[model samples]
Target chain A: MADTDKSPDSSRRSERSRRAILDASLALVGEVGYNKLTIEAIAARAGVGKQTIYRWWPSKAAVLLEASMALSGDAEDEGEWTGFPDTGDIAADLKHVLRLTVDQFNDEKYEAPARALTAAGAIDRELGEKFTRQLLEPALVLYENRLRAAQAAGQIDADIDVRIAVEMIVGPLTHRWLQRTNPLTHDFADTCVDQVLRGIAPR
Target chain B: MADTDKSPDSSRRSERSRRAILDASLALVGEVGYNKLTIEAIAARAGVGKQTIYRWWPSKAAVLLEASMALSGDAEDEGEWTGFPDTGDIAADLKHVLRLTVDQFNDEKYEAPARALTAAGAIDRELGEKFTRQLLEPALVLYENRLRAAQAAGQIDADIDVRIAVEMIVGPLTHRWLQRTNPLTHDFADTCVDQVLRGIAPR
Candidate 1:
């Protein structure tokens, strides 16, 4: 394509336009919400042509997801996105990751975009699946690996399905975040860890 | 108000108008989605005057909530809205209720409106809080009571907070439903109950 003209100046300009578009998308979605937000508005706000947005992102949802990821700086570097940590203690590791999640949810930059993305996911199934696969599932696999280590150490039952078990760890935290039912905190995260470790009921 | 004329004919007409308005709201929300839905369109489709809608419900979100509740038939009869059943087995009772939830999530009538409502809730905090208070909290209380019974029966630890423990039971089910990550099923609900009962790892 003519746009693929390989030149240092062109590459720098491309990067600048991309950043502008993402920034504009995030700001507009926060102000007007995802449903009313339009490609034209994003282009105008970004000081780029409408064609620039259309060329890079297929939909507003696409722009929002990329912008969210960029703003959070979590998935920007694929190499740095190295799953959850394993400090040898399953409970400690899980708590550590959950606390980070709580922090992310609490951050103002991430909150509005994340909320918009979640609402978009609920209404638009195809976009929902794409982002979930692109973003959520990879993180879940990390939990699965951590649980596997615990099973091998005999801290957990070997027979338990780690995939399902992982949900128990993450579900409550995400539920509270999405529903706004309660204040998410490190204390809440620690509670989830402790409860899962010994079970909610008595042995 | 002038419409408060207490006559059988007027009351019958009022009931007809209410039903029509609700039906129109649900159908329109499903077709055009919550963002595009308006009182004008709802009135036009319901074949009722716009004043008929404004006289009863304050906004589209209010109308949608009432219509959704009516469609689900869960909160229709206050007296019949008994809490979760107690079959003497805590696990069995929880599983039964969750399976019914799975069924509701699967139903077409519930699915579309519910999707719209959740998206609405995410963007509209005022509406979200209102519906959560009026709808979700009541059901959660039922779970709270059930867990307390389990605690009383010595099935659960007396010290375990029923409020948090209840989230462990319902969270995964809701997380899955909201994300559309998996098909919500009786089997999935049963797995959650079984996993929670015994804990994910060995005791």
Candidate 2:
């Protein structure tokens, strides 16, 4: 949503090279994990110079973040979703997004590399904070927007804190993925969505 | 709450040793991390024999898990909640628990070991699951019981799934702690409880 004016030709060419870099990053990271991945290795596999890789992105973390965003299609797909779904029915909208999320979690290519970045972030405070700003926070905005819309629509109860409400939907999926306690599936997503819309108290 | 059985003589002796082991395990793990922390190191540090360490724990990860839990005080406090507060108000009950959680997260002793175990858990699935069952899951069960009781007391909207709802509360805090995006404070905990209650819509 931020950049909408890149010319098609330039964009397409950039996309091609970007895809190559991402593919290289993913394969290398998957094979050796992040600590051992090198710019030289990325360039060799990407068929671009170390300069090319660094010119577009500053560090391995940057490249990997973009590469991850681009490759998993989580970034691309979620990038489009931007904030939250706005399909009128708040519950249905949340479920729809979460279901798509479940599919992305199932992607094998995304899983290993994704896990590597997340684990690294936990230890590396700088990298983790940057990721939140560049990656996680943008996605959170989508939730913020949707929650606001829901409030305006009177679907959500009055006096709800938009930030906290957003977490209700986001928290469970993340918990499942980070912990790997259970499968992140459509059914589970639906259950989470349903649970949040209404309270757990007996009516 | 389970086998932390109390006694005048044996129990106190056991508790003291358990504390020593947990303290040793936590310090050693923080010093060396999960990959390198060994039974020998932990036992040596605790001034107890390696067999004494093994008599209680089967592996380094288990020792670390229990150590981290014990360090957090969550292990001892599990069933001690006596269920969520019921001052005829569900939100208040939640806020009370969350406030205590904030205090726990802020404790310096818990922070290093918790971070260490959590980081290791991310990469080691079996240990991660074990950590969940022994540490995270039991704590989560406390929330579940609270939600169920809230349902019976007619505080929440009967239809909500307590499991999912509880995750919403837990997920954000865990995500923040593990990722270190922001501080976990009593105010934030209160916000989480309040927001989930009214829902996240602009009122």
Candidate 3:
């Protein structure tokens, strides 16, 4: 085969292997949980050799991190996915995004793997930091950017720290979802946005 | 021996055994993490038989639950510890309590066991619900009661749902603590309380 033709063919084959490995990691972690997930199992499930996975990823946690990033639509080509929307109304825009978050949290496809990753991260500090940097930090940046725009538009108090503001808006939903304290619903998301916008103190 | 004398002697022995068991469970979980914690190790550490632990608790989670409750000063006879203070100033009271929580989360003695239990609960639904009900719900209720009192005093909006309000006040701190995304400090706690009260939107 010509060198040019060989390069594209090999690249396509490598891409297929990468996706299979990531998919296998997610499915295995969901079935057996993070603790039991191993390179051997992922290799078997992906129909690839253990060395193939090792060459591509450093550890099971690394593989799971990429899988989760891909699942959340924040993978390598994340620029293709537009971030938090600005409908010119911060309240409505926040609510719209949060309601979608509520749906994502409730989806079965996301739930099992998320629980596994979160559970693992809670116990493993090193893994937790990596997970946060790769999977969580990008998402937080989006919130910060949106809040910055709102501040510029005079929708938010200029004096407020947007980093802390972002946490206050999203933290309640994350807490409820993690603790399973109550049902996650669009109404709950809307209430959080409204309450944050208008302080709980008497108006 | 006199029957009355024997009664008191046996009761003292039982009380000593119970305290030992609870302490051992906490220490063992801290050393081994929750997944590796076992009834046998706790019994050995406490200098009691496995049957004694089994008699008092159904599983390792039950033992750990009681241990955590005792550590938090929320076990039986909790009235003496005093619930969330109602000092007529909601902001001051919340910041005070949250600062204390920051200290507790940072304590080395509390960190290991808490991480283990929290990690285990994240992956195990049955245990997670029990942990929430036993360890988390009471703390949340304290926040709820404080918010309700603020509402009654006309400090907070009467229309707000106290449950959701409580989450907003505490959730950011919890998120930061669990994720280790940032330092948990008195300043951070105070900021969270202030932000929730005054809100992010313009004055």
Alpha carbon lDDT of each predicted model: 0.79, 0.74, 0.82
The full ranking of all candidates by lDDT, starting with the best, is 3, 1, 2
Which regions of candidate 2 deviate over 4 angstroms? A1-21, A28-58, A72-85, A199-203, B1-18, B39-44, B47-56, B72-88, B197-203
Compared with the true structure, model 2 gives a TM-score of: 0.77
Whole-model alpha-carbon lDDT for candidate 1:
0.79
Each predicted complex: what DockQ?
Answer: 0.54, 0.36, 0.56
User: Can you give the lDDT of residue B26 in candidate 1?
Assistant: 88
lDDT of 1 by residue, A18-127 (tens): 99999988888877887789999999999999998888888887888788767646443534344578778888888888887887789766777778877878888888
What's the best-to-worst order under DockQ? 3, 1, 2
Q: Which stretches of candidate 1 lie over 4 Å from their true place?
A: A71-82, A200-203, B72-82, B199-203
The CA lDDT at B71 in model 1 is 67
Query: What interface Cα RMSD is found for model 3?
Result: 2.1
Model 3, range A104-198, lDDT digits (tens) per residue? 78987778888788878877889888887887777888888988888888788777778887888889988898888889999999998987877
How do the residues B92-182 of candidate 3 rate in per-residue lDDT, one tens digit apiece? 9989888877877898677778878877887788998999888899899988888777887878776776788778878888788778788
**Which should have the higher TM-score, number 1 or number 2?**
1
Among all candidates shown, the one with the greatest DockQ: 3
